[model samples]
Target: MSSPIQRVRTCRDRGSPMMTGRTPRMVAVLGVLACAGCVDRRFIIESNVPNAQVYIDDQPVGAAPSHSSFEYYGNYTVTLVQPGYETLTKRVHVRAPWYAYPPFDFAAEVLWPFHIKDTRRYYFELHEATKTRTDDLLNSAEALRLRGQTLPAPERPALPKVKPGAAPIQPVAPDAQPFPQPGSGGILPPPRQDNPLPDVVPRVGP
Candidate 1:
């Protein structure tokens, strides 16, 4: 008879206010929150020597043996730097929650292509770009499509060879006459032709 009474009380207890309360409801709500969300992130930076500097896209991140992190879902650069070793960089892809990977040393990004620009304005400038020269204003895509004359080959004159112990050559005249040499004793007589001898005297043939 006592066991029957106890069972009845237990049955009535199911409908009681204390029997159905907020304890179970709170547990279930917390469980759902813990399971569904983005991961967390932690970044560790280090160097062989202590107190190395760090940077991101020319912006300073922190010092070496330093910790930096991001919570949002995106991409960020991790840069670790020391004096002696080359600059080391790591690209961290943070997805959802932040805490995904263990702490580690990392580095920033590297150099990109440089463009030479003319600062002055040309005859026309559609925009504020410093492409001052003719080629300066043109972009990669337009410059390729431009058709113009090919540049002429450069003319290279032949170099003159110098002779050993030789005086520099001078231009000579075509009808130049040789001058008489000083200190020469000869007054050269004019030669007479065979027929001209008759003008002086008629000669008898031997």
Candidate 2:
């Protein structure tokens, strides 16, 4: 026969283990639902020339030593321009960190307990543009002019003129003579001795 206090105390003792066992699970669930970890990614672009304008994918970002947030990891086109410096253009590849890769990315992005920052840095050097000398340009132009003067001019054959709606004139050989017209009464030239004409007069009254 247990007293009333003893029975109450025994019940409490039995319930304490259940409450104790559920505390850690409740805490873990609250933690998981309270806040999720996040990943911040950005890139820093720098150049040897100070104040050089920077462009990413043809969109202007700012000057050298500039930075911008990015969402993807891949190839990017970068262009730099400044006064008295040759314009520079190049392709940059942003590689993912070990934690940023598959399986691990899920943990780092959503399940991790802390925020993660991923930064990539890039640097470029620029060279001064070459200056052209007036004397050198003049010398090159003079050499070209002299070469042109020394070369012989090309000769082209003259074309004969034709009247509109008229038949085109045929070309004649240099040694060919014009045929005499029947009404012009012009006599035919004698045959050459090298190619005599055959004599075949028909017999009379036969």
lDDT of candidate 2 over 129-174, digit per residue (tens): 8876887899899999999999999999998888999999876866
Candidate 1 per-residue lDDT, tens place, 1-206, comes to 47988999987887676546777887777555544432334455555546667654455767765655544446666565655555666565545422223331111011112221212111111122243375654665465555333445679999788799999788796654455567786464555455554446667999
The candidate that wins on lDDT is: 2
**What lDDT score is found at residue 72 in candidate 2?**
86
Off by over 4 Å in 2: 1-36, 132-136, 139-206
Which ten residues in a row are the worst by lDDT in model 1? 104-113
How does residue 105 of candidate 1 score in lDDT?
12
